[model samples]
Target: MAREVDPKKTRKALRRLKRARKKIEDSEKSDTLSDWEDEFLGSVEDRLETFGSAFNDPEKGHLDEALSGLQTAKLREIERKAAGKARKPMSRGKGFKSSFKRKGSGPRVRDINEDIEEETPEADEIPEAAAEPSRPSGPPKLRVVKGDKGDT
Candidate 1:
């Protein structure tokens, strides 16, 4: 069964479709579109003429919407091409997720503390006094805990 559509939305979509058609036609006068692009425009116009919308799948768009999200995106792309823009290839974002964030994507900066640590000694550094370094029986920095509870 055909989904019911709003007449107002249908009229708006038709106007947009006509505008897209005009854009393609105007572009052809200066630079020609690929055979597929021309066919795509023709097919879209035909579909819109035959049916209220270009797409039949309800999941592709809302019942009242003339174009689906993807359809609108493609239309925009077509319009860009009509404006003589090059067809740039789609690329994945430089991220693990779509909305990923980070400090930067450039070369990593050296930590200031690393240079300081190399120049000086750290508390964690093993003493060179030991001829052979062995795991001591006690913690590295032994301290006596003196408290009222007689922990000392």
Candidate 2:
């Protein structure tokens, strides 16, 4: 026995499924902070809290400016550290040449010009239809391969 599905209910269900899928995709795409970011944010929060505590009711407006300046300085420091770390690898003498050569041995370099040239078909060349057979026209036929009973 088959139960009839209501068109209105089916449409509503599909809309809900689409919304759920969108929500999942959006959540996956949202920005996530790394360990360094978390640390930087924590430091900024601590500094802001301490700075805020030091000020009285008279200096609330000035406190905001000071906090902004502090944040900017901290951010600059973090950026400088990150940049320094990035440069460290390049600063080391072991560059591209050293990477390819055997360690503690004489430089056995290969000339790039000696490599074999590859022939590419010109734009005017049309590939044979036999190269790629057209998909079978009609419903796809499913094949079930029989395996040994012991295989499972």
Worst 10 residues of 2 by lDDT: 52-61
TM-score, cand. 1: 0.56
lDDT, candidate 2, 90-142, per-residue tens: 34675687677666777668988779687766746757863557689999899
Report the lDDT tens digits of candidate 1 across residue range 26-108.
Answer: 66465456777678777877777678777878788787776777877877787777777888899866677547555668867
Task: Tell me model 2's lDDT, rounded to 2 decimals.
Answer: 0.46
For each candidate, what is the lDDT?
0.72, 0.46
Query: Which residue pairs come into collision in candidate 1?
Result: none
- Name the weakest run of 10 consecutive residues (lDDT summed) in model 1: 115-124
Which portions of model 2 miss their true places by more than 4 Å? 1-31, 53-64, 68-70, 73-152
RMSD of each: 8.7, 28.1
